[model samples]
Target: MDSKIVLITGGSSGIGKAIGIYLTKKGFTVYGTTRNLKKYPDFTEFQLLEMDVREPQSVNRAIDVLLEKENRLDVLVNNAGVGITGPLEETPNKEILNAFDINFIGPLNVIKSVLPQMRRQGSGLIINITSIAGYMGLPYRGIYSATKGALELITESLRMEIKDFGITCTCLAPGDFATNIAAGRYHAPVNNDSPYKESYGKTLNTIDQDVDKGGDPEEVAKKVLQIINTKNPKVHYKVGALLQKFSIVLKKVLPDTWYEQLLLNHSKK
Candidate 1:
């Protein structure tokens, strides 16, 4: 058995599940998390552990079990997340809080649970699955961008803090991918009088279309495997189509007006 142990949150589906299956084929021991154990993956090489990233106790118990069984966790992938799409003003406060709690704080909970074990081992990798949205704010999904942006900042600061202990933290900023996010998106109710409803509908539809036609999840899985095999991984990476990846760079150097127009033109806002 490969001695490396990997724990991935939200592995029941989407990018997380893809990563788990891919890594297991490479001989790594992967423990994947699902909110419901009955929904566990059918793969023999992939073990399903019950977990809800929203709960600290669930996070702790799952990590404890993994460490008890493997004695060391070589990697922790914070892959669990949710998305909310609506005009910033129309989006309910409750929904905003939920998005933040799941996308931002959830990763922190998992990190806290796994750190002591990693510190004992003297080396570990914490990969926070953020998004390209984290770098640039999008209309309707502004809060999601905020949550991911927050995690990106956290990852940046965390890298320096734990480097001396042989622990490394990095942000995996994936571009659009074919996933279940479209179905789970929480869209605010459009009141009859809301001025932004027309534009909001158009923008959200464009996003859904992009997601449906986005890059394959296996591509992301391969990139992750490459990161795992390397002795020293970089601080950040973008995995997706060339255009999607290039947008980050273009945003960096473009004039503010040009960058704004590019985003608006693409989303038809």
Candidate 2:
């Protein structure tokens, strides 16, 4: 059998890095792409490339480089993303655009670039790292949830479209992995004279507390590996503790009004 070749975006750190390491250890050739090469050095089993998912040219160039080195590509993991947190009214236009670009458009760019190769090979996998926010709306994460929701829809459509081509698409929806995502949350510009100054501080504090309780990134990575090896990968795989499992069930069982009220109540506390 030919060795598996996997390409991962945003693999410099967090869940992406953990996935790269795990796959490499499992004997797959791992190619990792990141915008910050200086921050992430090359690893033993993984080759690092400079690529920004937000830029089509960068994504295409990186794909060309990989194709030139290896004639066949087996897997593409679209893990590059960003988060924006603030009241919708306070969030800037640029921040919202960036979140959508990185979270939703970025994956589409990668899929467009790599789909031809996978189609030719007649077998491959595309893993999308989505959040539970994709399914359940959360307070102060309107923009982020919107982006993930878009991804979820895309993943569903692609799964049916690509099945005929012998390619599989899996959307891995993790609840809250303990990752740097929280630290990297985008903050809206504040004016000292602004009326929302006091509320902004409280919002930031709430974000900090939520992030501190996020699940372990390594555990999420393990789930990614399992999905890759599973005979029948699920359209959506939820990872985390009981709370996360409950949330997913509730989203399906409860009415929208009740769900919204529950989220609003949690946010206030």
Best by lDDT: 1
Question: 141-231, model 1: which lDDT tens digit per residue?
Answer: 8999999999999998999988988998988889999999877779886667989878877887899899999988988889888887778
TM-score of 1: 0.96
> What value does the lDDT take at residue 17 in candidate 2?
85
Candidate 2 matches the true fold with a TM-score of 0.92
* Model 2, span 28-86: residue lDDT tens: 88999989778765455489888999999999999999999998898898998898877
List where candidate 1 sits over 4 angstroms from the true fold: 41-45
lDDT at position 206, candidate 1? 92
lDDT, model 1, position 11: 84
For candidate 1, the 10 contiguous residues with the lowest summed lDDT are 38-47
How many clashes would you count in candidate 2? 1
